[model samples]
Target: MKRVLTTLSAALLVIACENSKGPELTGDKPPETAGDTSEGDSETGPDPDDPPVVTSAGPTTEGETDTGTTGDTTCSFVCDTTGGTGPDIQCDNWGQDCPDGQKCAAYANDGGFSWNALKCVPADAAGGEVGDPCTVEGNGVSGIDSCAFGSMCWAVDPESGQGVCVALCTGSPEAAQCAPAGTTCVVANEGVLNLCLPQCDPLLQNCESGDLCLPNPLDQSAFVCILDASGESGTTFDPCEYGNACDAGFVCQDPIFASECDPGAKGCCLPYCDLSDPECPGANQDCLAWFEAGMAPPGYENVGYCGIPQG
Candidate 1:
């Protein structure tokens, strides 16, 4: 259950990588190659126009794609800019350090929309508890959310200031946790947001209405439902710069995994599948493990990506 913070909520994960803003994290590239490709038919063989690509576990080099676009902003930046929300008034998010009836919260300080600092803000004395419908004041980063202490307003409607109250992680960063069982605490937005997002199954795609199941921004070890920032494109083999830039069931993968993908592109979209039902597009592609051996969490052992098998 991760909630990425951006100037625009719907455009949250669309991380525009300007040096002044977003931090780089392996260039948001998803899982890599599954196997070696042998020359064969259209699906299994390299495309006539596209050449083979060298695969490796590293951040992609900054450049343009087949669509002739770069600086693609479609992932949350794990920023470290920690300026206080207000002058000489900082508060601890783990502890209710603010005066009674107030709570510690995060807000943007760099004239940007994402939260990078913490401060004391008024807590709704009569506000609903976790999972209750809530409202935010000013904007999402105003920190004037009408959520109870230890919770924050999430999924907010920009125009209406309406949203739901989600639980914040309880312990310190080293031992951060969610009180709710089965919930995963995702730390994002410069560590200002320690959200307790719900764990979900990647294969089922069983998230709420608009959100889609994807690996958490912090790590791919667990599955969490994040907003669908796939936008209008993110189709198969579409160039992507981040893990969340692809449409549902697709993730940004290395070009070597897909025969039709442009090797020059930073990354391309590939499908996620089950080991029992391998629906990999290419003839040489197979549903391979998304994580290293014994690295996957329980229940996620079968999670696989469509890619060429590794020898």
Candidate 2:
């Protein structure tokens, strides 16, 4: 099913990162050999102490796949500008062997069952810049063609497999990364990931004439500019596709209450408020904290919604 964000009236949240559940990288092991024997020793057997070996038919090229051979074993390596034969060690082992300004990271395969060979990746802003289209190709691994070190690829349209590289920033709004004049840093995934998004103010309608300043799907306190919903102004309990679809003073929230939306349902619109407010939409609704205490920036304790407290 297609993935979408939904919201609950009382409390709703969403994460910018897609929940694709890719495999996580763990410890490292010696590169596998093409031929294996139970005896563990053969003419093609690799010595455990030897550094990983790489064999390429010709000169290594950046973003190109090459075969790395150690003894009889063969593994694939994505060449970078480092010009190194192969990673001298796995990221889990000793430090990265990539050239200056680059780091090593183990990338998991698209199947989410295993990982490809370790490769050197830029440790700084040497690759794709923010807002560049990126694809999950080579070896079918996520983050393979990852953006520059401080950026991540966000799937803008899951069905079309279209994504854009966004720059990561710190959690604090004031300390967030510097961005273009019209944009600001927004907390995309709480403490996990932050991104530079267009600056907007929902209350002032500071966005473009037709755009809306809506709470980020990942964090209610953070706002971003998005296109105006085509139909009538959204109200509480109205279904919404993006947070910006809601009318002024209302936000699109996941229906699951304190959780993200289900894959299909985008969510319903809800009003946000400060706990200091005296009244709510209904008697059953009460002001409840939306994010954990430490999860949000300072002065956010009063940020909440008039809704049933989530368990």
TM-score winner? 1
Clashes of 1: 14
What lDDT would candidate 1 get against the real structure? 0.53
**Per-residue lDDT of model 1, residues 111-200, tens digit only:** 444454578888878877989987767655567877888898766654455677889887664566788777766554334556677778
* Global lDDT scores for all candidate models: 0.53, 0.38
Looking at model 2, which ten-residue stretch has the lowest summed lDDT? 22-31
Model 1, residue 47: distance off in Å is: 28
Best by lDDT: 1
Question: Where is model 2 more than 4 Å wrong at Cα?
Answer: 1-126, 137-141, 170-174, 188-190, 201-212, 215-222, 225-235, 238-249, 252-268, 271-311
